[model samples]
Target: MGYAGRHVAALLQSLGVACSGTVRNVAVAPEVIRDAEAVLCTVPPDEDGDPVLRLLMKQLRDSASLRWVGYLSSTAVYADREGGWVDEQSDADAVDETARRRLLAERQWRALARDKGIASSVFRLPGLYGRGRNALVQLAEGRARHVVKPGLVFNRLHVEDLATAVVAAMRRAEPEALYLPCDDEAAAPQAVLAYAAALGGFEMPPAVAWDDPSLSPALRRFYAGCKRIDSRGTREALQWAPRFATYREGLQDAFRG
Candidate 1:
C-alpha cells in the first residue's frame, strides 16, 4: 500500500471497519475484492493503462457482494486555470500523459460500475500530505524547497480529510459521481514550505525563481500548473468538511503528530 491507502486503511480500521490491503503484486487482491462489500481503488494507471481494470476487472465484475466502488483520480485532469478555481463540473484537459491515463482509468472504473449496476465515485485529488509524508518531514530531511512564482497557487488535502471524505462517499454512494476533495485555500508552494519550516523550527530555504535553472524537470512541470481546486460542492454532497481547512492547520496537525 502507498501513503494514501495506508492512511485510509488505518482510518477505516480505527472506526472498527474490517479492512484489508494488497501490495504491488496484488496476490490476495481478487479474494479481497470478492469478499468486500465496497472497494476503493488507489492504484494508478501505467503506460499500458489501468492495472486494476486489466487484471482484476473479471473478479470485480463477478463479485456478488460488491455494491460500491471508488477510484482515486488526480485533479491534474483539469486544465491549468491560471490560479482560477476548478470544481467537479470543470471540463478535463489533461496536460500530460500520466494525467491522460488517469482520466482513462476513471472512465474505465465508472463504466464497469455502471455496467454492474453498482454505485461508483471518482475522487479527483490534489497534493496530499499527512504525518510522515508532509512538508515537515521534507524540511526535517533537508528536502524542502521554496520556489516563487507570482499568482501561482496549488491545492493540498490532508490525508485524514481524504479518508473521511471517502468514507462519507461510501455511505452515500452515487452512480458515476465525481468529486473534488481538497483544502479551502489554494496557496503558493513557497508559502506552504515556509509555514512548515516555521512550525517545525527548521530554517526556511531561500526562495528560488520558478524558472530557476537548478529546478528539476519534474519540479518545473509541477510549477507549470496554476489552479485552485474548489471542493464546496463535494462538501455539500458528502456532508463532510476538511478538519484542516488550510495548509496552516494541516501543517500544525502534522507537527503535533
Candidate 2:
C-alpha cells in the first residue's frame, strides 16, 4: 500500500471494517476485489494509463458485493488559478502530463461505476503531510528547504484528516461525487518550513529563490502552481472538517508526536 492507502486501510481496520489492498508492484489476489463491499483505488496512472483498471477491471465488474468505488485524484486536475480559489465545480484544465494522466484515470473510474450502476466518489487531494512524513522529519533529516516566492501559496491536508474524510465519503456513497480535502489555510512553502522549525526548535534553513538553479525540475513545477483549494462544498456534503485546519496545527501535532 502507498502512503494514503495505508492510512485509509488502517483507519478502516481500527473501526473494525474488513479491508484489503494491493501494494505497489505486488500482484493482487482476485478475492481482494471480489469480496469487498467497497473498493478504493489509489494507484496513479502511467504513460499506458491506469494500471489498476488494466489488470482488475474484469474483477471489479464481476464483483457481486461491490457497491461503492472511490478514486484518489490530485487537485492538479484544476488549472492553476493564479492564487485564486478553486472549488469542486472548477473546470479541470490539467496543464502537465502527470495531471492529465490523473484526470484520465478519474474519468475511467467514474465511467466504470456508471456502467455498473454503482456509486463512485473521487477525492482531489492537495499536498499531504502528517506524523513521520512532515516538515519536522525533513528538518531532522537535514533535508528541509525554505523556498521564497511572493504571492505563491499551496494547499495541504494532514493524512489523518484525509483518512477521516475518506471514511465519511464511504459512509455516504454518493453517486458521481467529487471532493476536495484540504486544510482551511493556503500558505507559502517557506512559511510552513519556518513554522516547523520554530515548533521543533530547529534553526530555519536558508531561504532559496523560487528560481534557484539547484531545485529539481519536479520541485520547480510544484512552485509554478498557485491556487487556494476551497473545500466548503466537501465539508457541507460530507459533514466533515479537518482536525488540523491549518499548517500550524498540523505541524504542531507532528512536532508533539
RMSD of 2: 1.2
- Per-candidate TM-scores read 0.96, 0.96
> Taking the tens digit of each residue's C-alpha lDDT, what string does model 1 give over 151-215?
89888999999999999999998999999999988888888888888888999988898889899
Tell me which residue pairs clash in candidate 2: none
Give stretches of model 1 more than 4 Å off. Answer: none
Global lDDT for candidate 1? 0.88
- Please identify model 2 stretches exceeding 4 Å from their true place: none
RMSD of 1: 1.2
Least well predicted 10-residue stretch by lDDT in candidate 1: 44-53
In Å, residue 5's CA in model 2 sits off its true spot by: 1.0
Evaluated at residue 95, the lDDT of candidate 1 is 66
